[model samples]
Target: MHDAPLMLCAGEALTDMIYQGDERWVSRVGGSVWNVARALAVLGERTAFAGAISRDRFGDALWAASEAVGLDLRLLQRVERSPLLAIVEQGEPPRYFFIGDDSADLHFDPDVLPEYWSRDLRWAHFGGISLAREPLASNLVALAEKLKEQGVAISYDPNYRNLMDERYAPTLRSMAELADVIKVSDDDLRGLFPGVPLDEALRQLRAAAPSAFCLLTRGGQGASLFHGDQRADARAPAVAVVDTVGAGDASVAGLLHSLARHPGRSLQSHLHAALAAGSAACLQSGATPPPPAAMQQLFELLEGDAS
Candidate 1:
């Protein structure tokens, strides 16, 4: 049997068709959970990606990209179906319209995961549009429960989008309750609780998942972490704004990287690394991770800031 990956990222892996100019479009590997898994591997974590991929050209590209990033692909299953496609317009906040229903991404089978995978995994991460969908959402929740029972840490990013507003609250509460760490954006807060104040919205989320550390990310303003009687915040580093495509995913990866090493460190330490990783991702385009040298430079800069 293959050794277990330190981290398992479960959810959708799809192709994003990004608008460039008047008529030009570019397709890239895109999905919140996939992005987090890829970023962790790029940042040198022993990570595995768990998602349903099609056997089509787009899926081939996605799989090849995962291999290039050194992500363990054993958990990636292929099927005969059209790939999920997202038409992304790089607006101020970036707009997305997903194409293709009943695609392979939503067909992930929890039972297919290797029996030994639970033993080697230190952490598992899930969320995004995957949780808003049908069978996959329930599958992921069950997987999280199983992993939790096995003593594996679970992280969730409610990277909530308006497209998924309907299922937002219940799913958020569900995953947040099982998560060891939960990351939410200011936007997610608004979407989850429109009339409530930011603090109140956050309080509601905390109440639902009292045992988890909830990290609230205020894009550009930085991020904050809320735990039991513990709070920490950090400012986003200054970087050229390329695109905020995968900034949150990168932040999750950074936090996971730090947690894998210093799981018991203060929230402030984790936030610092997370902010740096998130900011560094904006220096590139299309959810691609920064080069190791760039990440190193950013980390050094963060260290200097702390000093």
Candidate 2:
């Protein structure tokens, strides 16, 4: 509401039904862009989860979680539609399915978002299953293009899912072309570019967005940042990782927030902040917004290693 800078993470906000054991499952409010928006706001950015949720129990939880993280509610939309959900069968590697048809997410009306929201916007992020769906996906793609033309910085993370097979390659390329920053895990690379060698896929992805600051995260192995002809890599500072749930989201948030906050910082410094934030998220369970104190401690550790 104030004239402070705003960032929009435009995508789905869903209820994650994570299976525990023997028919037990716990519900959590999650989605790629939702997590990014929450992580950014948690890191003190004036952020908005630019999507819609059903006016149901799932929506209720998501609404509260957004507020708890200090997100600007004006950019949030609630509709009288079915709630979107990610039904997860957690395992060594989780398998999941989306359970929403024409849900509230698909009904998000960008036209109704706060007037002049774009005026102070610093960055606009896109990705998640929201980009793999219709009407909504098309609308989001158009929105990203519009914002880019308006000179707003754009960031993207495909957060690849089964839904985004070869059909998503074009969207990937186009969005990457417009991105000022992009985040992709190695796993995401494999999934998004199926049948291609990982290295080759990454090469092609980079070619699509040659000027964008590309953050390539390799889970606990750490991350790499590509800028023009230069590359920066950092080993993830060790942590007793409790859950990697939102680590990628947290890392992307860290990198983008740092880039927005300190555009003059070295790429290595930004990468360290991202790795620190990702590790910080791992210290907690169930995609909790990480504590700033924890992030700083880990960030210092990473900085020490570099020095």
Candidate 3:
């Protein structure tokens, strides 16, 4: 058994219809939280995913993939429906088309939270379509509040999709209030705070979630960390780009892994590790995270560069 830090990820778990050139599509198990959970597990973190999955074959394959990646499935709920599928397109900034209507993932119920699920978890993460959908949105928000009350560190990634209602602003604000850490991409910031300048966006986010440590990601450039009066930014090492699907989630996992392993390390250390992890994911073709060895190698390189 590896001595890995315990993490709880709550949100959507589904399949991705990846565009493989001209009009060709391939199915791959993916979801924002799923990608984050998989990345953490692959990096040797003790991880558990909480979501309602379908009873169909796609759901079974998702469970198998989770198990194979070492993610605990005790909190997974099964429904008799089908899972969500996202049609992904390749471009400068990849676009996604979600083909889910009342999918099982949207049916996640807080009442079904297992008794052993919350205990021992040091960190909990939730966001993406999970926060934008129905019943699950409310359920996930309640879960985050409970976790915060239990003194567990909470992280949020608003992997926003356009399907969300315009009225979702309040929900986003509320979630930001409860999170101990918040991760957002430049696109997310623009979408959430339309017309707001970058600096003002960060300032407003900090004002909204006063206690939360915020990280703003810039796709190919790298990421920025904002905490108290301290701020750190790093540019990702230039690498051959393969796919950008889960790079943001990979960055979240990397940041969490660094914080869990070296609690109270300088902000620069966290940013450096996160950039490395995210850059490594770009070297792969799918949403699956890079191996632990790859993460370790990048960490070493970052450390060397810092020294």
Candidate 4:
């Protein structure tokens, strides 16, 4: 819509209230899909964030961050609803809870997006607790299905949260089957399918979307890819982690960035790039996506070592 190719990330964007000692808490802008959008934009991709944020102070922070990241603000919605907040009420071990019902993110109206946006969209990304969050989740599923019919690619990552209980199973399977690319971490596999072994959970996922490119991230253990019957594995580069807040978001964005920017390259190489970007994200604190230089440096380290 804005001349260059467009990529949309449709999901939640909320404020993260981190405990800062006795009685202080600091707020920061964060949301899984939003993080991916920022990472994609930082990688020079024409990205749009299609989520709704409130007009309040918390929403102001998110709006400013999105604008600073060069996102196409035209597709971003500003609403009068309350902002969603993830409060890390405890510092150590990070015990947190959400604060908001009928928030701005749930008020996102897909019909209001730019007309014919799907025609130019390289891909549309969906996932995060937003998928587990009720009426909004249904809205996104319907949107994704329509976009699929229009021939636009779809990417999904169900960054599982405690909120995703029994009600989330259907959405999980539906999104897995609908996405062109689906990413799930080892932890997600366990959380999403309790009591199911890791391999069994993955098998179930493959059965749901056997043709989709499946990315399996195992944190420090590395990552693997499955497409058809062929599988590829790549080990992650060890880095001093400041915090793993946005690492998975960076990894997924890194994979997409490589695929979009390096057509015809091997999927194995792309996986390595993802690991590098994820490692880069850990070098910094909070939910920030790595700049191109940091990602490229780790990418080179990975590519060079592999070669």
Q: How would you encode candidate 4's per-residue C-alpha lDDT over 1-307 as one tens digit per residue?
A: 5463478889999999898888988988999999999999988889988889999998899989998989887878999999999988775655888987889998999888777666777789999988988788999999999989988889999998888899899999899889889999998999999999999999998788888888999977889988788788988888888988999999999988887889687778888888888888999899998878988988888888878
- In model 3, how large is the Cα lDDT of residue 241? 83
Residue 257, candidate 1: C-alpha displacement in angstroms? 0.7
Candidate 1 clashes between residue pairs 3 or more apart in a chain or in different chains: none
The digit string of per-residue lDDT tens for model 1 on 65-164 reads 9999999988999988888998888666768788877899888898877777767789999988888877888888889888999999999997877677
TM-score computed on alpha carbons, candidate 2 = 0.97
- For model 3, residues 66-101, the per-residue Cα lDDT tens digits are 989988887788988778888778545768778778
lDDT of each: 0.85, 0.88, 0.84, 0.88
Which lDDT tens digits does candidate 2 get at residues 1-307?
4664478899999999989899898898899899998999989898877899999899999999999888988878999999998899865676888888879999999999877777888799999889988889888999999999998899999999888977777788788898988889999988987788988988999898888899998875778999988899988888888988898899988888789888998889999988888889999998877777898898889888888
TM-score quality measure for candidate 1: 0.95
Better of 1 and 4 by TM-score: 4
Candidate 3 similarity to native, TM-score: 0.94
The 10-residue segment with the lowest total lDDT in model 3: 1-10
Model 1 lDDT-worst window of ten: 290-299
Q: What is the C-alpha RMSD of each candidate to the true structure, in Å?
A: 1.6, 1.2, 2.3, 1.4
